[model samples]
Target: MKLVPLTDRVVLKQCEAEETTKSGIILASAAQEKPQEALVIAVGPGGVVDGKEVTMQVKEGQKVIYSKYAGTEVKLEGEEYIIVRQNDILAVVE
Candidate 1:
């Protein structure tokens, strides 16, 4: 099944955290931190939210940086994804 975000929500796939350090030492999974970078998979259409008109600034295929603790995690077709409000997205990577 495919995911389609509604309202100002955005669907994202988390970028993998580095498995090794620059020194070439492999880090264990327990030592790895969640990546803040993500790839935009889908975006919701802009509409009125909370009595205010909202516009989506990010688009599908764009790389984005989001708040560390933002969004909800979901699993679809064995792949993980996060669904968050557009406002939670801090910036779009150029």
Candidate 2:
């Protein structure tokens, strides 16, 4: 099964959380914060949405930063993914 986003929705695979701090202190699982960065998995074709013409700026395989607390979590075939609106994506990592 595959995910096909509709309208301006986007699919992403989240990057793993860091287990240790920059100072070299190992953190517990509960203390690790989820990273906002993710890899673009799939993207929806952009068109008229909410009466506005939208164009997709992000592409599949691009790393991106998304808004915190955004998107819906999905589990597919033992793999986890995130689905969010294109607007929820903040920036693309170079």
The best candidate in terms of TM-score: 1
Backbone clashes, candidate 2 = 0
lDDT for model 2: 0.94
Model 2: how far is 93 from its true place, Å? 1.0
Regions more than 4 Å wrong, model 2: 25-30
Note the Cα lDDT for every prediction shown: 0.92, 0.94
* Winner by lDDT: 2
Candidate 2 matches the true fold with a TM-score of 0.88
Worst 10 residues of 1 by lDDT: 26-35
Show pairs that collide, candidate 2.
none
In model 2, the Cα lDDT at residue 63 comes to 97
What lDDT does candidate 1 reach at residue 25? Answer: 95
Clashing pairs in 1: none
Give the Å shift of residue 57 in candidate 1. 0.7
